[model samples]
Target: MSGLLALLDDVAAIAKLAAAQLDDVAGQASKAGVKAAGVVIDDAAVTPKYVTGLPAARELPIVWKIARASFFNKLVILLPVALLLNAVLPWLLTPLLMIGGAYLCFEGAEKVWHLIIPQKDHGPQQAETLDAAHLEEQRVKGAIKTDFILSAEIMTISLAQIEIDTLWIQAAALAAVAIGITALVYGAVALLVKADDLGVLLSVKGRLAATRAFGRRIVKSMPAVMLVIATIGTVAMLWVGGSIIVHGVHDLGWHLPYEQIKYAAKVAAETLGAANGFVTWAVTAGLDGVIGLAVGFILIPIVTRVIAPVTGWLFPEKT
Candidate 1:
């Protein structure tokens, strides 16, 4: 009886310790996740556009595909790469992040270019002529590639939040953060894409008059909502890309831009008084966006003329 009680006591202590470790991991993950919330919002905002113009039935499937790729990007690719870089060459992370930033600037700039130049509209006729599966493939690839950059940023931010020296604990916390953030982002996207379909169903099938009316309103409102989301997503890409470059240069010891932007925001904040906080943020973001746009314009021709052709020749896209 005494021997059994001793063994039981030992097991109970171990269980308690394990539970405590899990609690610590959870706490760390939550804190790290909060740090990456801005990027998380950007990820959520940017993803829905990929599903736009896709078939209603295919929307959820496309979201699922991108979400899966997001998981792989964070866990299999980014997490290991981040840990390796942090351990061996912490200085390299910022440069790599800036490269991704430049790519974002290019993408956003290209979109703006199309808007300004008003490219030949590929309307329903073009969509009908093209193989939709190929289009789907292209969009999925783009989303996944973009997600990789965003996920890298998120993982790096989470890794920075860790004060723990233990490797396993750090890994556990980062993994948790990655999974949690990805789920939240893609889940919200899935909901946004399906909302119209849900509204249609409700409008057609609901028994109550109010419910049907509400559903009809939702159906009516969704197109505008999607447009707004796309606009926000494009602006966010520019803002995020530009902010990354500004901070990247600052990290590389080019402090003038960062300082100037910060100073302007501060002045605006003082002038605005109670609305200072928002005005300050707006100023900072606006300056960052301008920088991003300039970088984008410079890169657009090079990418379109040189990079695009080289890539097309080398890779030869199927569709």
Candidate 2:
């Protein structure tokens, strides 16, 4: 009986240790996820547009497919690559991050430029060319390609945030963050896209006046909500991109730009003394975004006139 009691105590201790390890893993994973929040927000914001014009029945399925592709991109392709890079070529991470950051800046600036000067939509011309199935496949493929870049950034950022010492722990943390964020972003997209249908059903079939009114409100506000969400995503992309570049520069031994940005942010905060934290953060982010836009605009001409033609010339297509 005494021997049995000793074994029970030993088992209880082992169980407690297991629980503690699990808690640690969860905590680390959550921390890493939060660190990649900007990328996650941008992901959620961008994905909905892919499904915007699809048939209602197909929207969710397409999102599901892309989400699966995103998973494979992060886990199968990116995770192993990130791990290998961490082990072998840690120095390259900063440059790659800067490349991703530049992409974000370019995209954000392009959107703002488009909004300022409304371009002629040749969308109808292209739409007339492709049948529904072909268009769907093209969009999905395009979305997956885009997801690969974003997923790489997400995994890299998450990997950087992890505090674990072992490669396995780091991998697990990254996987957890990738899975969680993908589910969150795509799940939110699925909801946002189908919300109108749900609202219509609720508004028509709701038993109570309050329920109907709430549904009506949802339906009415959807357009504005979508615009706001899209704007948020763009802003986030710019802010995150600028911040990443700043950090990348610092990592690469060029500290001046980063220090200057931080100093500017501090000064801005001091200028608006005692205001809400949001106000301070907004000021900082806005200034950073302006700086990023300037840099991106400067690069635009160089990229378009110089880089594009050079790449085309270097890689002529096969007949």
| Model 1 C-alpha lDDT versus the unseen true structure | 0.85
Task: Choose the strongest candidate by TM-score.
Answer: 2
lDDT of 1 at 232: 72
Please list all clashing residue pairs in model 1, or write none if there are none.
Answer: none
Off by over 4 Å in 1: 1-42, 49-55, 121-142, 157-166
In Å, residue 217's CA in model 2 sits off its true spot by 2.6
Q: What lDDT does candidate 2 reach at residue 105?
A: 79
Q: Per-residue lDDT tens digits of candidate 1, residues 161-250?
A: 777767778889999999999999999999988888889889999999999999999999987987776667667767877887999899
Report residue 44 deviation for candidate 2 (angstroms).
1.6
- For candidate 2, lDDT tens digit of each residue in 1-319? 9999999999999999878777767888899787677778878888887775668899988999999999999889999999999889988877887887887877777778779888898766766787878778877987997899889888877777777767777787878888888989898998998999989988999999998998899999999998888888788777877877778878888999777777776777777787747666776677777766876777677777998799879976442
lDDT agreement with native, every candidate: 0.85, 0.82
Give all TM-scores, in the order shown.
0.81, 0.87
